[model samples]
Target: MARAAKKDAGNDTISLIPDDPNVPRPRLHKLIIKNFRAIGAQPVVIELDEIVVLVGPNNSGKSSILRAYDLVMKQGSNEGKLETEDFPNGIVDNAALPEIELQTIVFDKAPGDRWIGATEDGEMLIREKWTWSSPNVQPKRQGFDVQKGDWDDQVPWGAPAVANSRRPLPHRIEAFASPEIQASEISNLLMGILKDRIKTHKTGGEGQEKSDYDQLMESISNLQKNVVESTKAEIDVVEGQVSALLEKVFPKYRIKLDAKPEVDPEKTYTPFKASADLLMGPQDGYFSKVSQQGSGARRTLLWTALKFVSETKTPNDGGTRPHVLLLDEPEICLHPSAIREARTVLYDLPKTKTWQVMITTHSPVFIDLSRDNTTIVRVERAQDNAIHGVTLYRPNRSKLDDDDKRNLKALNVCDPYVNEFFFGGRVVIVEGDTEYTAFSLVRDLFPEKYRDLHVIRARGKGIIATIAKILNQFSSSYAILHDSDQPETDKGDKNPAWGMNSGILSAVNSASDSSAIRLVACIENFEAAMFEKAATSDKPYNALVRIRDDEALQTKVCGLLDALLDSNLPVPDGCIRWNALEQLEAGVAK
Candidate 1:
């Protein structure tokens, strides 16, 4: 998981808007799950955010929150205790009953009827209670505000309890579901302002002919008054100039208000399908092709549409301009070159009031290549299944001292990269960094083998200790890859170490497969081969290798590095092979 390369970690750009005493807070900023699946007999509560990301194993119930949202929207309330149809795939079979209740805690924000449209000055607060029985969850008015004060001190706009008692929050799932649907797909997720663009260049429609006729008549009446009072020559000359100016201003849309170009009667115009990507794309037709495509293509197309819409200005709605937005799993489908360009597109849009968006992925390319890091998320499923949850770690204010900054002067010396991935999520410890990199990378090297790969490297205390920590947390699986060896220092044991890694994976995911994806050797020295082969030549290691060399081979690796350094080769990859041991020998003589 790549981190946010933040310039200002602690500050939020949106200052808290003041509130009125009458207005109540809006809804849903926190979640409280009770006896919900693995979340023990004791309950677990997590706060929600504007950009909340749910992440965990396949069965850890990370998707439970979304399921809960869908249910409340569908059935309408959280009353009593829930039954089968209340959740995804029915009855929470994988999780226990009675112990399977998911209570959602809601926080309050703005106020008023914030549905279709709100007057610039209106504000409303909403709170929802969800149990197993009611489809009409109460939409009580906590309070209202005039245009100004902190949320901490606000009063209700009206007698909210009495008013809400009179009118129900319209059982319209459309209010909430629409935003979800819109956000889920790229083409559907137009800038909030795009909905108003059609109004700007509006064409008359059926059933509005009488109104149109009246408007046309009014315009003609105004024109007639001008024509009768003014000199015909002056009017004609002015009209001609206006037509020419319009043509110049909008060369692509040169439809004249006063004149038409002469044309041949028998001329044929070719049907358009080629030459421009825009013609076959979202601009002219339903972007149905994108949805029909696989996930990767769809993701890329989503990003493409966002980039296209953002570059072209959409009309303003009310006082705000509509922003077209698209988000693709930036690290996934597209080529690296495309990802870099797409990141630029994403960065440029959000600064405008017209757009706001976020993208996600697990690739390292983005971290190294990005110009900025305002948004990024790391997701991990815990090793044990007992209490499943996801951690959303951002580069916000942390109490890092000067020593911390000094320790991270180089990427090589920094703490393990996956430290944050396991931050709020479950921890699955492995042998070392090599195993971490190897487990994830090797699958790609041999795609025919692994299905879904998740790996983390625990720095010390061996795989057994890591597994032990995990076993105490969740029901996880493990996969240990080690070699056959005699008891060198009484620190080696095959079964215990193997169980450790496998146990952690199984425990956290709560998966049935509790065994390790273990690999053991009969009589070979695995570390020896690994060290000599995957030669990661840091300065000290390479320096030793140079001393071991007979001056000739030492000159070779040095020459290669120097030459590449001149051409801007990355340092992380300057040296990664076996000459270092040879250099160590020459150093011994010195």
Candidate 2:
């Protein structure tokens, strides 16, 4: 067993031994929340991916999950004491207190370890409960006993003494959106870097700076002692008065005042106690505080500080605690160019081997579909009137080929609105720009009825299957509108359009049946069916002019839009559903 050793027999100070070399480090795997703010009594379990992205509407409980993790970890200072608002619906008389459970996994473990009821593959569960019944009782932390299938309160795994012994909790790093730059947030990041560097110097790090740093710390320590000695007379006078008052109650107790306040140099200073003010100036040399700058500059400063910490805190040989970053809407207050740059940095951060990232974003630029082991969770309030998080996209279910990945990356770069469907309720996937232009305009005609409708332009038929598969994974009720390029004669042939049609149907059928799917195809092409003409290169411009001037074409477009959005409406004429494709091919249905 590892033990701490005292320096002397009479000394009260003891030296701490390094963490156990044999025990495996724990990584946060999942979080289960119950009776917390915005979430009801039923537990909501969310699995943490290497790079998980949470995208949803406002006030949909996306931020609550991030706050819940910080509440349990207590790494960030933003979370204060729990109040009535912390409970579900702010009613706590007959309700259970809020509970947050952490599920962790440790790889390459030995036979038996300090984790009380860990599995053979090294899975462990720990929980924290808030106190609401009494004011004096603090929060409770416990572990699960797998053998008995119950929770055990005797376990002190996350307490201060046992946390850093053999089971070290991950260091939670957080950056949230604010109306303005918070000096304390930036100060904490900067001071953490400064302290880490000072620690490196004190511990036999290379260079003459180490000696200089030690000398500086010694001088400061001596100054702290001198100040206490000079105030000894004042302290004695106060102690005499305090002891006289105490003697009235005990009548036999004697009191002595010993004034000794010192600084350890490493343990004394922190960002919470002190602030680091950043000043910016132009070439003319008129410097001003960062707080006086614009919102853009302050946001940029926070981004830069976060990047600096991530760069400096590189992975060591299991000596440092693991880090999990919770970033809320990084694209806020950033210019378009800056948003792209921030997205690249955040997407690449998890590759550092010691960091895991989770972000809640409203911008599609922060989401990358090509990344591996990435999960996109869509948070929304369900019919049950409780918040729910559904996995909208994951790498395992996607099965994206190289070509599909290239197409997705190109779309992510070229089109800013390609991912808007992830935030919509009923989506319509169209093949070309003409359909997208016409359908979007028609949907706008009935703004209130089709307010939740999202029209996504695939730009090509090959990418339709990819979008369909993703929608299927989301379990969304959506429609796909495509062009039937050939007649029934070409169905048996090796036409690429036929192959693409089969692929789209196959993807849609994998997860949903006909009730949840709406497949519409325009015979020959969109222009041929709507205007009785051959396909033209300027179809998008023609669509605009025709929809604006021609009433007949506008009526036809509205019918198709209604068929796609409302399941009760039958498939409109000149448009073919999946089952009627054969009839249209034989010139019978149209």
Error of 1 at 545 (Å): 10
- Number of colliding residue pairs in each model: 70, 0
lDDT of 2 at 202: 39
lDDT of 2 at 119: 39
Q: TM-score of each candidate?
A: 0.37, 0.76
TM-score of decoy 2: 0.76
- List model 1 lDDT by residue over 402-489, tens digit each: 4333322222133324333332322333444443443444345444534343444444323323333323332333333332223333
Where does candidate 2 stray beyond 4 Å? 1-25, 75-80, 108-137, 156-158, 161-181, 190-279, 283-289, 309-316, 487-494, 512-515, 579-590
Error of 1 at 261 (Å): 48
Q: Output the number of the TM-score-best candidate.
A: 2
* Per-residue alpha-carbon lDDT of candidate 2 for residues 416-438, written as tens digits (9 for 90 to 100): 66888777578899998988988
- On lDDT, the candidate that comes out on top is 2
